[model samples]
Target: MEKNNLYPVFLKTAQLEILIVGGGFVAEEKLHFLTKSSPDAQITLVAPLIREGTAEKAKAFQVHLVRASYHAGYLQGKHLVIACTDKPQVNEKIYQDCRLRNILVNVADNPPLCDFYMGGIVTKGHVKIAISTNGKSPTTAKRLRQFFEEILPEDISWMVENLNRFRKTLKGDFESKVHKMNEVTQHLITNKN
Candidate 1:
């Protein structure tokens, strides 16, 4: 049986600089999801012709638009890169450039060339869930994300906040605190059936 070996992590995009090569629909899609997940992410888009919708969306976020062709120089000072240009050669070049600079790169729709996959993400206040299909089926991941969004309680964050407040008031060793916390939250997983 095949299993996914990819590790999942959450990044603080606000602290990292991101570069996207191209301004087509794929680029726009990437930009939309990135901003939706991390509103404070600093991003730069370089393309000779940017779509009007993409440009308009940039106005609402901290996104810089460089109306020019992509070059290796654009990779400078960038922590992450996304290549989604209409030209396969240009996108491949972007990927190669990113590799040389030790920057993480994702080549849109090309799983083999991508260093990372942007999975479906569901965010509810402080609670966030990321779903991945190991770069195999993104549509399946999207459906799972929608399912989770519907099943999760809207007040889940409030419960988290209250637990945190209660945790701070407890004075004990780390192990004891963990045990007590587990006991308190055990009911959350109780099987009623």
Candidate 2:
């Protein structure tokens, strides 16, 4: 039997060391996504020949572009790694290396091999929503992102600011503060007015 089990959580990518292996269209696409979503992500790309536009994007994003083929040593010190090379054998080697080292890795387009799936993310000020179709369909996740983008309130930033202000004024220990905040924002989760 197959499993669609995945645990979702947001990572602080700004401080993480990310490594990408590949330089073709797949690599370019992954890099583009990271550059926009994780602007501060420290990414090192290991590729012999980057596809067109990749250099420009890498320069713009300040990615450490390493002009070389894939090697196991590149995985050192990396918190998250993405394998998107054009050659299946190279990608498999990288994946196997990551597995041996017990590192979190994602092998693009191969759901069975990936440790994590990059879901469609919709970010608005203080509100960020991640949409996933259990790695079954990225298209569905993307459409849901568009749907959420339209429905999300524009004053969400204001709501967050006010909530923060309220929390600051409260006098309590950590647990009490959490309880008070949960009381205020519980409706958002339960969908009750």
Candidate 3:
């Protein structure tokens, strides 16, 4: 059976430098979702001609914009990169450069050249969920994200905060504390009717 081998991880984008090489719709979409999830993320965008809308969005997130073509020099100090340029050759070159520098790179719409896929993310107060479709079906991941957004209660974060406070007040060994907490929260999944 086919399976997704991608390991999911949450990143602290604010602490890492990210670069996006493009100024088109794909680049805008990536920037939008990334900023929506991590408003403080430090990002730099390099494109010869940037759209007005793209420039406005970049300003909203304080993204550094360079009105020039992408080059290997832009990869300096960058931890992650997304290549979505209209020119396929340019995007491929970006991917190759990143590989040479041991940096993670994602070539938009090209799974074979990507080291990571930018999956759909849904965020509430302190709760966030990411959905991936193995880079096969992005539409499926979007649908799942919408479904989760609708089903999850708005106050889910409140419950999590309360649980955290309760956990801090517990007095017992590690195992005993875990057992007690599990018992306390068991009703969440158990049918009481």
* C-alpha local distance difference test of each model: 0.94, 0.88, 0.95
For model 3, residues 1-193, the per-residue Cα lDDT tens digits are 9999999999999999999999989899999999999999999999999989999999999999999998899999999999999999999999999999999999999999999998999888899999999999999999999999999999999999999999999998999999999999999999978
Alpha-carbon error at 60 in model 3, in Å? 0.6
- Candidate 3: where are CA atoms >4 Å away? none
Taking all chains together, the TM-score of candidate 1 against the true structure is 0.97
- In terms of lDDT, the best-performing candidate is 3
True-structure RMSD, every candidate: 0.9, 2.4, 1.0
Question: Candidate 2, which segments miss by more than 4 Å at Cα?
Answer: 1-4, 173-176, 186-193
Give the TM-score of each candidate: 0.97, 0.89, 0.97
Q: Could you tell which candidate, 1 or 3, scores higher by lDDT?
A: 3
Record all residue pairs in model 3 with backbone atoms less than 3 Å apart, i.e. clashing: none
**What's the ranking of the predictions by lDDT, best on top?**
3, 1, 2
Candidate 3 Cα lDDT to native: 0.95
